[model samples]
Target: MSVPVLLVVEDDRALSAMLAELFEGEGYRVDTVYDGQQGMHRGLTGGYDAIIVDRGLPVMDGADLVALLRSKGVTTPALILTARGSVEDRVEGLDAGAQDYLLKPFEVPELLARVRALLRRIDNAATVVVAGPLRLDRVTRRVSGETPDRAEVELSEREAALLGTLMAAPKRVFSRAQLLASVFDGAESAGAVDLYVHYLRRKLGKQVIRTVHGTGYRFGME
Candidate 1:
């Protein structure tokens, strides 16, 4: 498997270098830029799996960089690198299209977790679809069977995995722990799982998935 590429934009040379080394060690191709101008140029023009941008930059601000990228229709998932840990700052980053916010002085594990989460969301949006009546193609991540409802649906790998597990035992509830083991792998979150379930409900429509209220979630037998 080819290493996923990440563009790290931070004016802090030491920090960027550290991130490059860390991510490179974990099977990722890291491209690091230390100035906002170069960061924007690389981030916008380069093909990257994800972007980690610092909010403060020289020559160009990080927010402006992201905003410009968005204007040009760049939709790559972005994670903001901010020293300000205030809620308002985090909100600002999110509003600027930053998917997740990481404060300074965080551990490497947390960064890896957030990166995995972002990638999961991307992969999820390209896999799974309802083909036709009594037909589903969660594998190969596309709709092939006839009579597809013309609705665009995608499930994250984790969601697809969990759904597959549940389908293996249709009409059975799998608790949170079960799903954490069989589904999340390492980037598991109950809220993320619930969010994906909500997405499936919208794709499948009319209560196809049921929540057991206390235990976890299950796919209803068709």
Candidate 2:
């Protein structure tokens, strides 16, 4: 599995570095930005597994940043950090779209625990995976484009499993052997990987999956 990517949008340089070190030590790929504007830019395109943002941020408020992300259909889990612990402040942050809130001067262990909880919740609740214009509903085994008039296409069991495996770790290249083991359970030959790739491309469009030459394939919706 690919390392989980995390975005830290904290203005304090020291704190950001500490967060980076902390999460990286825990096996996550961490990216840090010092302001809300940069946070918004990264949040929109980063494909991060989770985000940590300070409530008070420069250029744009962290709450506003989270709100904008939700408006754009970016459902990556978020945890808001703030010194403000008032009920109203907490409510505002939660209302804006953060899944969890942590006050400043928190214990490191508690912070880690909260982030783990957020990740677990997201993992359990993610029945639909959205990549750019395409939305894959795992429950229904169907894929659909964003346009209102676009029809949803049902996928075969193996096809859906293959697509879900790739979508789960977007941008990570998966070789035929890896895919065959994970999706085909080593029952199918490596060539079957290419055959199913053809099947998916035929149903979803040529751009649905990108071949990476000798490496393998990665999600291609971008």
Candidate 3:
């Protein structure tokens, strides 16, 4: 399996570094960004297994960021970590779409435990899945279509993640909005999704992914 990716959104450089080290030490691939705007961009696009976001941030607040992600169906598990630890604050955090809330000056063990608990709930997705004759490797970001005699084609990071998302839930019929939220991170427009669909079709072959008319796209036909 590919190492799970985690996104940490904290403005404090020192704290971000510390958290990155903490999670990286625990066998997770960590990405750190300062401020809420950057966090929103990365969180939406990184395809992280989990996210740790600070409540108080410049550009955008943690609650707003999480709310936007949730509105767009970016359901990556999120944990709100901030110094605001009032009873109402926890309720607000949870209401904003965070899976867990951790106060500042927290014990590392407790934090780790909460993260693990969130991750544990996810069905471990495979690193590779076959869509028709196309073989996609999420870990290596490689897609092999056609036959062995054909050259193996490499996919861009976004392409690989997008393909992985589709193949992971074969025939699930992901709408363009759903694909934008889960695959594109809610940053890219729906047209971007269409463009990638074209790109994937050109490279992998048209039959690899199916368009369900006005509904959305699915991986291979039944």
Candidate with the greatest lDDT versus the true structure: 2
Write the candidate numbers in order of decreasing TM-score.
2, 3, 1
- Root-mean-square deviation of every model: 14.5, 13.6, 10.1
Model 3 lDDT per residue over 21-70, tens place: 99999999999999887887787678999999999989777876776565
Stretches of candidate 3 exceeding 4 Å from the true structure:
123-222
TM-score of each predicted structure versus truth? 0.54, 0.56, 0.56
Model 2 error, position 115 (Å): 1.0
Worst 10 residues of 3 by lDDT: 123-132
Residue 147, model 1: Cα distance from true site in angstroms: 34
After superposing candidate 1, which stretches have Cα over 4 Å from the reference? 123-222
Best by TM-score: 2
lDDT of 2 by residue, 51-130 (tens): 99999999777876776565344688999999999998888787666899999999999999988887776444457766
Q: Rate the local accuracy (lDDT) of all candidates.
A: 0.66, 0.82, 0.79
On a 0 to 100 scale, what is the lDDT of residue 209 in model 2?
Answer: 88
Regions more than 4 Å wrong, model 2: 123-222
